[model samples]
Target: MRFSRILELGCILAGLFSGAAARPQDELVTENSSACKNPPKRVEWRQLSTTQRKQYLDAVLCLTKKNATSGITGAVNRFDDHQAVHSSQTPSIHWVGHFILWHRYFVATYEKALRTECGYTGGQPYWDWSLDAQPANLSSTKAYSTAIFDPTTGFGGNGDYMQPSVEQNPLNITGNTGGGCVKTGPFIPSAFTVNYPTPDCLRRDFIPWIINSFADPKLVANVLAQKDYTSFARAIENVPSFDQPNIHGSGHFGIGGVLGTIGSAAESPGDPLFYLHHANLDRILWTWQQKDLQTRLNQVGGPITPFDYSGKNVTLDFQINMGRLAGNATLKNLLNTTGGTLCYTY
Candidate 1:
């Protein structure tokens, strides 16, 4: 068999076996040829001290080299291509498919890279928003609550009560003003709502709700109100999949708008969190695969034509070379595999 064919077969087999056992270190491979291990539980966000945060951030920085950037671009191109082919006809189906494929590769590849490059040995940690769902649990410094919701500061505007904006306003006047300025909010006692014409449109204001929903029931409801990761995936699975105005269509607008706005406004690489946010979005797809393994695995779909942006038909294929997106070794190899070297546990 040809090498590519053999690789494809291996990937299929790996995907079938992914759920069978606890992931072992040897199953993962990196450029360094060393085994990767799971991260320590204490490495979670709340547990990290100031020094640890600095260390972790520095390590993450080192791992995100120029080459890593290129690899990410490649992954994006693949995604763009897939979307163009499949979404045009059945948008919802296409997006859910896109989510699953993209996240499977992302988590697998990034985990391997973290293990081999930064000596990071744990599973990826998620920011749970359940802790601050209630008005009382929010802290001045850590948790967002009525006490810290600042209109002038961190993403959202100040005070427990502030003026809300129209749902269509992408500037996030209630959260992220212009580009850099963010307003902080103190936790509100009410169940979070993302009503149209309320600055909460598109769920931008729900970031705090998402951050606090991990362990809190009320917070989970708040996050759910804005379509938590699971609901987002389910929305894709539901009929009229792509047309679901709230998630996929809005998601495209959100991502495309940010790219356009940030590209025009700054010379620096937009937000570092851009990739991380996408990564989390990708993780939702991974979780979906775990839930409906057979149905998800049997699928084979992509876009029909490349997207037309500013009159250009963007190319989508593995052959095209993207600058920072092309160079990352882990991402480069991941495009062709179901899970590649690493198996996802959670």
Candidate 2:
């Protein structure tokens, strides 16, 4: 048998035996890797000191204040450049083979911009939203009430309350609590603006049901239990329904308003929290990969065409394009978070 076939089979077997174990530091990714001499450690949003949080927010704002460096003709700021890349290639990237790997690269590039361009000193931070969606708080998830929405210290609170008026792709947003523009928080009209499909307020409609029912810890644990790389990817990307709630999609709907509305599901990068949100998903993918790193670090499978399971299977050599932000990279280079092109760990 060819090495690729042997490798693919190994990944399937490892995942079958690897249950949804809690994320661990079983083997340090960059500890002995020569390619990454000093990898940055990604932490949870709440782990950052007040100063670190302030720095991250400031770096994001700095991108907003600068002019675009890419050829995205519609973009107005450095930050908009990233979304322009996403907005154009939105459909091709999601519900496809490259979904998780592509987003991991995209978020890492954004993080690099935050550090290299905006002078952010620390690595990227992820928001473990499940902590706020535990069973105890299942009835009324601690989503909107947490410090993550602190007007002074965190991303601002819910937009002015507006009844739900949306139903998109996989999930329904009828239970949204805020639909108007965000009036508080760092990205409010006074402080931030998004320029894609036209300039608009950064809106958020914290849906407790999304948290209580869809994005709760149980969904995450379930996704982690999948028996293979392909199965895990399919599970994570499942559209939410009464029987199944997508952990990945739930994060977006949980912050419903404009992030959910713009581009169906593509232009989420318009919201500043998009990076933090994606970082957590990457963390989940990374945790899943860590459980069987030997097999998983090289294991990637799914269709090349978005939502077309019958299409050609994407291989490790498939090229993922990111426009001008980070240019093109192969699926193999992005497989491992540490020694490959990426250099960070959660």
Tens-digit lDDT track for model 1 on 1-346?
0111223333333233222332333223432222223323322344445454445444444453413222221222222222121212121212232343434444444444555667655544433322334434422224443221222221232122223344334343222212222222211213122111112211222223213222234422332343233344434323322222222222222222321111111110122222333334444444544555554433333332212113322112211111221122222223222333434343
* Candidate 1, residue 245: how far the Cα is off, in Å: 7.6
Per-candidate TM-score against the hidden true structure: 0.40, 0.85
The lDDT values for all models are: 0.30, 0.72
Give Cα distance to truth, residue 81, candidate 2, Å.
0.9
RMSD of each: 14.4, 10.0
After TM-score superposition, the amount by which residue 170's alpha carbon in candidate 2 deviates from its true location, in angstroms, is 12
**Model 1 vs. true fold: TM:** 0.40
Residue 78 of model 2: what lDDT? 87
Winning candidate number (lDDT): 2
Model 2's C-alpha root-mean-square deviation from the true structure amounts to 10.0
Candidate 2 lDDT over residue span 1-346, tens digit each? 0111223333333232122232223223222356665678899889999988889899999999888975666789989988877766665676778888989999999998998899997889988888877545644857777777778778887777755433222233355577667787688888888786477787777767666666678878988888777778878878424355677765676776323332134347887778887899899999998888888878888888756788897888777766667656678778787764677887
- How close to the true structure is residue 320 of candidate 1, measured as C-alpha lDDT? 18
